[model samples]
Target: MKVMKVAIIDYNMGNLHSVGRAVKHVAPGGTQVEITADPDFIRHADRIVFPGQGAARDCMRELETRGLSEIVREVAKTKPFLGICMGMQVLMEFSEENAGVECMGVYAGKVNYFKHLNIAHLKTPQMGWNQIQQKTAHPLWTGIKDAARFYFVHSYYVEPTDQSLVSGETFYGLNYASAIAKDNVFAIQAHPEKSAEDGLRLLANFMQWQP
Candidate 1:
């Protein structure tokens, strides 16, 4: 039996153990989940899960310092790529964080800090569970109901120029792109690993997704 390999990119941003375990749990039998920063390993994997935390500037710097920036861009174009949190944010053209930072530019968008919330109860980071409204039907959302709640922890959110790329949206102070998909790449602002059953189902769908 052949073993499919899933690479969880490590760029010194945050711990990948939870993401690794979640992927391994949902992966079909004989699938290997490796948490690595090695370019060769990432290039050879059947799928790539890029989960990140911390500041965008720091994360991008780490990827460049380790010579993994180009590799990530290449992988996104050719393979089944899933970007979580900061991983998804960095795909944009630029970020307003750290006094403005340039990202991979894979997607034409900008990451902006949450602003102008009239509601006193809402927070900037938008932490905890939030409902995701499916903007469009896709394989990654299979078996997951519309408006499913997912875990989120970020002060900045992505605003893609092209609305068609938005696969899901969530509202806090306003409706923002919670999930974006283009070609073989699908990214979400939420943490599926931390989320419960629906999150697991999404991961399983990604494992079997062909497009």
Candidate 2:
């Protein structure tokens, strides 16, 4: 059996299919990527991937219903975890989306909608490709460039109270935390599966990341 087991957490609100394909693509022949909702299966994995897309209310609601919320928090702290898109947002203390949401509190911060920013000229849900300015050195960003462009599709952006934890920043209407990292957890507000070359490079890096 492959010793490197990567669990793409399935809380029923994520793009598991795409994310799994992405991970498997970069993963070596000796690595195994499993999409699972079983807590024990996830807890035992070598790496964890928390991926989500859509409203905060639904994401939190589903996680609670499936009893995966706490598991997510626990695994994030214990392993090399990667949170993508809504996965990254929910790691914060709260979110302005869906009329305020109490997040997992993994980080001290909140997610905000672009409309609430009061920048009328700027478009909400800054979709398509955007450049990420690397603010810190990380194993996941091994081969990626400094100002690498990644795929993003969200109206809400995360603002962490601890700005020092931010690994990457992106500018839309304003500069916001596109990625954050501390210890074994690395979270990003972009979808690597749809990000093409650099995105694949990130996943490739994560597969070998010792953190």
Candidate 3:
């Protein structure tokens, strides 16, 4: 049987092993998950999983440093792309981290810090399990119940200019886009690898998603 290649992009930002293991765990019998930063390998993969954890400035710097910025932009335009955490933030136009930083600008949005909000006193990162309110139907949310809790660890959240792009929302102090999808690109602010059963189920669905 032929194998489906899934690439977990490694741009020297975060741990790729866990993401790779989760993909492998849910991948069907002929699916192969490769963790790499090679442009050739990424361009040729069947699907791309971009996951990261770090400041937006650092992440973008690493991507450019490794000469993967354009590669990522190209893959995102044509493949079933999944961006997690910092991966999701980089899709926006700019981030308010490290004073300010320019990003991939795939989506017309900005990443903002979750501070000084006059809501419930929540921590800055909004870490731990949080319920994801499904805003629209998508293959990525298949079999996943509404308000399913997922693991999140971040001090900033994505605010897309087009609200229709938001596929999921979660309330830390205020309701913010927890997931966004457009065409072949789907990004989530949470970490599916550490998100347990529902998270694994989402990954499994991604493995079979035709889009």
Q: Candidate 3 on 66-175: residue-level lDDT in tens?
A: 99999999999999999999999999999999999999999898999898564566788888999999999999999999999999999999999999999999998889
Per-candidate local distance difference test? 0.94, 0.92, 0.93
Poorly placed runs, candidate 2 (over 4 Å): none
Winner on lDDT (1 vs 2): 1
Which pairs clash in the backbone of model 3?
none
Q: Summing lDDT over every window of 10 consecutive residues in candidate 2, give the lowest-scoring window.
A: 116-125
lDDT per residue for candidate 2 within 1-211, as digits (tens), equals 6478999989888789999999998998978789999999999999999999989999999999999988998998899999999999999999998789899999899898899879878887798999999999999899899999999999999999999999999999889999999999999999999999999999888888887
Q: Which tens-of-lDDT digit does each residue in 94-174 have in candidate 1?
A: 999999999999999999888544567777778999999999899999999999999999999999999999999999888
- Please give the lDDT score for candidate 1: 0.94
What's the CA RMSD of model 3 in angstroms? 1.0
Going through the candidates in order, what is the number of backbone clashes in each?
Answer: 0, 0, 0
Rank by lDDT, descending?
1, 3, 2
Q: After best superposition, candidate 1 residue 161: deviation in angstroms?
A: 0.9
